[model samples]
Target: MKLFKSNEWQRVKKSKAMVIALAVIALIPSLYAVIFLSSLWDTYGHVSNLPVAVVNQDQTATVNGKTENLGQNLTTSLVNGQDWKFTQVSEKTARSGLKSGKYYMTVTIPSDFTKSSGTLLGKSPKTPTIDIQQNGGRSFFAEKITDAAAEKLKNKVSQSLQKVYLENLLKGTKTSQDGFTKAAKGVSQLGTALGKVQTGAGQLQTGTMTLQTGATTLSNGLLQYTGAMGKLTNGSANLVTGNTQLAASLQKIGTGISQGQAANAANISKLNAGFDKVNQGLQQLSQMQVTIDQSQLNSSAASVSSGLSSVDQNVTAVLADPTVQEKMKTDPAFAQQVSDLKSNLTATEKSSQDLKTSSAALNTAVMQQISGLKTQLTTLSTQAITLNNSAKTAIQQLNDSLSQVANVLATQAAPGATNLAQGATTLTNGLGQLNGQSQTLNGGATALSTGTSQLVAAENQLTMALQATQNGSDQLAQSLANGAVKLSVVHTGTKNVQALTNPVKNKSTSLSTIANNGTGMAPYMMSVGLFVGMISFSTAFDFITLGKKPKSGMHWWAEKQTVMATVWSAQAVIMTGLLVLVDSMAPKHILMTFVVALVTAFAFNQFVTMVIVALGKMGSALLLVFMVLQLSASAGTYPIELSNSFFQVIHPFMPMTYSVDAFRQVISIGGLAINDLLVLLALGLVSMVLTWLMYHRKLQADTVLFPKTAEK
Candidate 1:
């Protein structure tokens, strides 16, 4: 208390210079508070004054058949808005303005801006960009302000585009919904058609079963027919053999007669014996049991025809023999006999040809029946077993019919044998004429004549049977071809049904947002105001003045702190008053704002006192340095997260760190100021304790920024 009322006080009270200096000292914090806080108070509000250049070169683009110029729209919006003082310029002008510091930042809208914007629905979508270039040489705050403006412009553009995109997307969605509805209806109709097709397929399946049954029946009938034909063929073959024997006998008679001029009289008895054999063979043929399978009719007839051909060939070869021809010319009776044998042989050959034609017809009929059965089987696909019993029954019926035919054929053979017997008698008479001729030749001639007559009878019978078989085969083939056509319809119907079923389908959301950059940075800048105000307080007042050493360090610290605290209190009051005058502080908590400022001043005063007392003039220099550090590190303007490591490390220990927070809490941002108050007060208490402990030596031996010289 005495120190407070001592020489320093008297000198301060008496000198106008000291009072003016103290007043000026007080003005420093007040001026800083007014200038910094008021400047930043409505920074966002006055951002329209911030210099920014807009270079819009965007050309119009066609989007969904609509012309749009996105970049031009953005520039126009920015120009009309009060957010920034947007200077519309060309690209070259914008660049020059940015470099010359005429504009803090330049936003260049590329020529493809609108084009790229329209590509939102393209296969390769491109994000439209607004290129922002900031002037590095500008004041950091100016640059930051311009950057925020740029960000705001960008967000505005994005929001506008997003709204348009959403509208277009909704329109497209509506169109797609309509298309999908129609497609769904079409698919439903297709499904209904498929259902009808499925019903047809079921009917076709039934028809296929019927076809399977018919195929089995036809197959069985073919089997039975083949058996009958085989029997018939065998019988015909036997008859042919008998006739051949008769023809050979006639030939033998002719040969024997021709050779009568020679001493081949033994041939006459052989020829007569051949005639007996021919008659016996004819009798054997009449009684022979003939059986044939209809399926083998063609092959059997072919065999018969082949045999006839061999007979004809043998006859020709024999006639062509020089010896036989010479004999024929020399013996007139032999020639007559040979001529009769040859005429009989010609008849036999004609019958054979007729038989071959009949056999061919029968063979074609059988093959057609087989083919028809195969077609029906193919149509049946999986239902062949259903017809097993019916096929067997049909086969039995066919077999019975064939048996009846065979019996008829057997009866018919008797007349053929009678004819053959008469032919044989005629042949025997011919052989009598050749009684002294060669027997082998007479036998050959007789056999050929007999074969011709029997062959004629067999051929006529075969022709009738083959005609019947051919009619049945033709009917079967027609039925099977119809069934195949029905199955083809069923197959096509199944394919159509498959195509109707759904084969392809498509599957389809709206993101979170942030406050504008200006709004987001408001709390930080408000906090920065408090820190700048505190730093100004230090610069305004001098704690370490040129003085004599104090006897007691505790009294020295107490007196200095009291004076500093008084000045700081006034400074805080003036600052808060200026804050109110500027209308910067939150009007709702005007009282709290003052209290916060006062508390902040007290804390800041203690900190400055401690630094000066502990470190003398060096302490003041360090405090100034700390003030600069706190500007960045106190997380006042920018986020603490963006601060460097060194500042971050010391942040918790600095009183301005809490002061800024406390000011912001009481001012613009509304939060619990208690924590900041607690931290500030705690830091103050720490500074006080540290000053008490550290100032003892420094107060007794303090140094000023300008030390006085000792008396020379």
Candidate 2:
């Protein structure tokens, strides 16, 4: 304290130059802090002063039948934004303004802007662009500010376009919903029709079974008729033989006139019995023909064929449905299902064709059998009648001939024998024709049986296919109903569309809120000013030159400490006070800010003093270099991580880095950085100790070199 009063205050009190120099040193920090902070007080807020040009050449376009001038709307929005000085100008003027530095950026809206925007809803859409040209050669910060404004303008235009697009999309969605509703109703009706078709398929399947049963019955009947014909054929052969023998016997009797009348009468009675048996067989055949109905069978087959055709048509309709086709494209499983259904329908169609062919053939064969049987019955009946009449005539002739046997034998007996032989030959021929027809009928019956069996198999397959088709239709109806419900449930209101347009929103909260550029930058500026103040003081004041011979190096250190502490404290007060008063910096912890500033000033003073005291002018030059490095490394404007690796590596070592952080914590809403304050204090104490050690070494060297000066 004695050293400070005697050595520092006496010099300042004695000379006006010394007092003015000390005053200038005290106020230097304030000048620097206030001047820099005030200049950057609100850089972004004053961006409206920066000139930018807007060239709107876009014409009108139609969107959804409504005329829109997107370019004009964007121009109006930019003019009203107040973020930038957006001047409406021609393209040539905008370009010249950019070249002449009259504008930092020029935004050009081409004539096709609105047209391209309108194309968003078209099949071939065009992208709308807003051309932004920036003049970076002008003030970099001004160019950067305008660049930001341009980006914001782009965003505003995009939002507007998006809002219109979303509105149109919602309208289109509503239209689609209406169309889907109608389609759903149509699909429901189709489902009902398909249900009826399914019913018909079942009935047709039953009819097929009935037809198959009838075919089996007809086949069995044909087999029985064929066996009967065989028996009849054998009997006809025997009758022919018997009749020939009877005719020969009659001839012999005619020749032998002594033959008895009883024998002739007996042979005539046997012929009468044979004719009655033949007539009975023909009656049985006629009765069998009456039981089988041809028309009914043909009608059932036609009905089944028609039902199969309807089913095929319905299947085709389902496959052709747009909803099903869309599903087929997206869903592999659904595609496979449709493919299987198509295969089943194809098989059902083939079966229907086969059944129709078989039915026609069966009908033809039955008709032939019935007609042939009828004709054969008619011929056989006529022949039987003639034969019966001949037998009775022969009986009457025999009775008449009982009186004249030789003449009766010579005339009527021989003629009766010849007539019997002719009747027998005709009967045999008819039986042979019947037998040949029976074989043909048997073949038809066999074919009909095979076809009916196949038809039954096909009917079962078709029934399964129909069942699958019914299931698919039901699913389709349900899907359409679901889709319609979903479409109805969607909300396409203005608020919802807006929400969709900007799906993500930013919600930010700051732990330490900086009011503006000035407030945020105040800490760095204050720290730099205080550092420069210390450097200035170090350059101006003589810290190493002793005013008097001291008892020890500690005494020299104490004197310089008092002078430095007093001056640094005054600089800290002035700088901090000016930040609050001039720059309007309202720190959260005002007292803490003052305390941090004072400590930072002291830390800087000690560091400067230590280096200057140890190395004199060269140390001052080194501190200047250090201050420059600290400016970049201190993370004042940007984070220390954003700096180069060298700066980042040395950032922790820089006293200003801690000082800036400490100032921010106290100035902003963040809590005080106790660790930073401690670090600053530690740096100051270490520098002070280092200065003391250097002073101690110098005193030792001086004492050795100059014993008389040291002793004084």
Candidate 3:
């Protein structure tokens, strides 16, 4: 064993080409790492440097009487941001840039952007949008970063618009509060007015009842007056007829009085003639007495004195006799004739004396009575004349008055009385109507009172509702004020958020293309290449030389492992230095990357050496097969979970699996996996043990590739 080790070392040290070939063979894995890991070290750090295009087509518009240019503001904000290389371009330019891969994404503001934003107060407002077009053909990550920037811009615009909306709402709340206050006051006044109306309606009902009674009394009085008028009309007609008859009778009485006065004058003249005749007779008789006393008494004094005395006595007696007075009264001519002169003369003297005596009485009684009669007749006549005249005048006046009265009774009074009767009938009907209407009026007044009461109740309810509304408005106003304050805070927060527009800052560590899964595939590819390289190396060279086998299996394994360790260490150190020179290793994990890569190479070499020792050239074929299986289970390009169940089960057993995991931590994420390193070293130790045991068994069994051709 000692001689074989010395021979192998001398052979490698003397052959220049062998040294150069081994050195070049060790650089193979480093080349892969340098190419792949350089760009993946800080791949996302350069995302902000990616270009984006913007097209602003939005115009300015008036929103609530204020001029606004939303698109312009959005454009300015995007241009000022450092998240992306944004530029204001025309629509054509933006489209072309996105298609040609000059820009990762294109953001477009439509012409109606401001117009749509202004419609926020309308019934059905539309959401304003910013169109983002990305070139999916370019780097997917680049497109994603630009899309994120566009989304950020949209959020900023939305926050600013919401601030305006809150301000307007606050103003509206103030106006509504004022209106509610006024409504409350108006409801109070309306309640008072309704109460007054209810009181008035009750009074009106009472007054209507009183009016109904008065109308009834008036109707009765009118009926009585109508009857009186009828009677008065009839009486006027009777008076007219009686006055006409009285006028006629008075005229006749006037004529009779005038005739009686003339008759009375004639009678008085005859009476005076009779009274003169009587006086003449009395004078003659008185003269005769004187003559007889002078002549007849002297001549027949002696013879007739006695006889004459006797004759005087007898004549006195006869004259005094009622029979002679009756005869003389009956025979007025008896005293005018003188046939019995002596006797008659004596008788006449006696009669004369009696006549004179009676005349005196008669004149005293009869003439006085006659004079009184005459005087009375004269007065009566005079009065009758005057009365007749007056009567005629009165009659004329009465006739005139009666004629006028008759005409009045016929024309005026009669018709007036009839009209009064008709009017009374109408008044009766009117009273009946008034009574019914009064009842209806009472019902109406009652209804009015009830309606007014309802109105007052409604007004009171309205007042209460208004008070509640006022309180609600006040609360709403206060809430709006609080919202405004909160909105201000939001506005300030959004403004500050603008500084962090690009939350994901992508940086590129190297100028190398790291496409999809390129970084992930790097560690797997490096592991496979190194493992295959070691396998090919083991086949090309002979490190274990067993000339005399009088050693323990452990001693044989130790000698082979010592040589393999020296070669694998030199290869791992060369590859690690090359990766550092190319800037492939993460700067923070520089030392860890070197250590993991060197360890990974050692582990891979140990496993490949064991497989070759166990089966010679056939073992190389088997190792190749195992390499294929480990590639699938290594979890390099894809996680082990994504592989088939068989691959997942064998993942931990695969030597390259732990190496890939450790390399990823050191190179990409700038970390060290101590557990994976231990696992890899343990796998190496197991492979060494298996290789030693298998080599010992092959030697003991005298196993050779060609048994019949050669024998020891």
Candidate 4:
């Protein structure tokens, strides 16, 4: 170990290349470890304690019906730092705060939030609709924290709704209990009320039945009473006539009796007068009795003998006349019997006269009533007929209006039918046109395809014909060459004899022809020789590393440095050559070209070597970064300021990036001259110095970091 260490230190100190290689290798792993796994907090430091603003527009809903506003219950109950932080502000303020970056994001609970409480059985309810406005783009940790808070707010709202739902259900149990008690009380009261009501209803029904029967009986009685009044009226006419006859007879007989007494002629006249008077008085008395007809009046048709009160009395006492009185006076037994008969007749006649007076008054009242009822009934009947006619006329007018409306509707239907027919025809024509167009298009496409095929075949045939023509031309030229050779020999033989005239001219002419041919052939051979030289250069480049020992870090380092220098130098030449070759071979400043090439190559080598050193031979993936970032990107062809951001980012680090810019400068300035080379050189030099330092650090490590897990 001691001898090996001495030799290794001697070899390292003797070679600048070995020291650099060992140093770079030793530092690389530590840099990676320090970069990747240094701190847990730094990775997540940007996300902690992000601030957000939550504005709740809804005020808490009152338990009672009256209050300032219905609030967001969740917002009201939200525990700050636990559920959410509520920053009280107007919507504009919240928005302003978020925009000014005082807060990362702003959330607002909307109105109409009670709907969030509604849910299925035992499930958590959803949160109310809320607006979460983010000021910055979503990439920031502030936005992420805002999102986390919003989700927590949603979950807490659901939890609150769950609590409220359960509370409501629990309250319902008490409500149900109260409801059951009230229902039971109501049921008992209803039963008692129903029983009383049933009793009352039964009583009412019985009373109604009784009243119906009474009404029927009263109706029959009213009808009978009407008929009795009519009968009384009819009987009054007959009684009137009888009374009138009695009155006339009483008047005549009274006058005749007076004449008979004056002349002392006959007692029969007095008797007749007295008998008629008695009859008339009896008729008057009959009016007082309660017969079915009371319309027969005593005063209305009574025959009163045209005498005073005494005469009426006398007539009443006609049954007690003197002849009867004398007979009663002559015999006691006979007189007693006659007096009793007279008393009985007098009472009966008096009773009949009183009844006649009452009947007259009643009949007058009944007739008046009957006349009023008949008038009312006739008026009602006329009104009913008039109402019937009016109703029929109104019905006829209504029917006429309805018929007119129906006719109008039926007549207007023709336009709709015509429109429908036109629409159908238009639709059919459109469909037909579409089908025709489709067919035409299909045929056109097929013809286009055929044309394309013919065109392709024609082009192929033309190519083959041109190729065959070229081959035939080559053959013709060869045959012409052989013919020329033979002609030359024959001409030389022929000119040998004519040497005196033409030998000197032919010699000069042949020398000129030979010189021109040599000039043409010389260019072709030189081109081939240059190509062969390019191949040899490539072969030398491939095997150059074989001359150096792998064990000697200096050999490896020197090879790498030489390779880097040559690559940069060659890249500069080729880049300039490419410009000269592909384009006008424009004037270039070779110094500026070399400087740009060196800067670009150094930067590129560092980056490429970094990748290769990191991934070994598998660093082919780095080419993807090159092609996409350099060639396809504007960093190679145009100014980075004109390119997109991604191109601008890597432009300073890419070789073509500086090469392209320097190429433009060299071409524009007309020579190998540029002051901007300082900036480019500084970037490359700084990057190279850092890379060298990194390599020096890597040399201190005992072993390679990758693919060498075992220490031994």
Q: Clash number for every model? A: 48, 0, 8, 29
Give all TM-scores, in the order shown. Answer: 0.47, 0.66, 0.49, 0.27
lDDT of 2: 0.69
lDDT of 1 by residue, 524-563 (tens): 4434444444445455445555244455556656656655
Relative to the unseen true structure, what is the C-alpha lDDT of residue 309 in candidate 4, on a scale of 0 to 100? 28
> Which scores greater on TM-score, model 2 or model 3?
2
Tell me the alpha-carbon RMSD of every candidate. Answer: 28.5, 11.1, 54.3, 55.2
497-526 per-residue lDDT for model 4 (tens digits): 333122134333222221122222221221
In terms of lDDT, which candidate is stronger, 1 or 2? 2
lDDT per residue (tens digit) for residues 153-197 in model 3: 776776677566535443433333333333333333333433443
Most TM-score-accurate candidate: 2
In candidate 2, which residue ranges exceed 4 Å CA deviation?
1-7, 121-123, 170-187, 191-472, 478-490, 544-548, 557-563, 693-712
Full ranking by lDDT? 2, 3, 1, 4
The reply for model 3, stretches above 4 Å from the true place, is 1-6, 144-563, 570-599, 614-633, 636-653, 660-678, 698-712
Candidate 4 stretches with Cα past 4 Å from truth are 1-48, 59-79, 82-93, 100-102, 110-128, 135-145, 192-712
Q: Judge candidate 2 at residue 163 and give its lDDT.
A: 79
Candidate 1 residue spans exceeding 4 A from truth: 1-11, 117-120, 123-129, 151-566, 587-635, 639-641, 668-712
CA lDDT of every candidate: 0.54, 0.69, 0.55, 0.40
**Which candidate achieves the best lDDT against the true structure?**
2
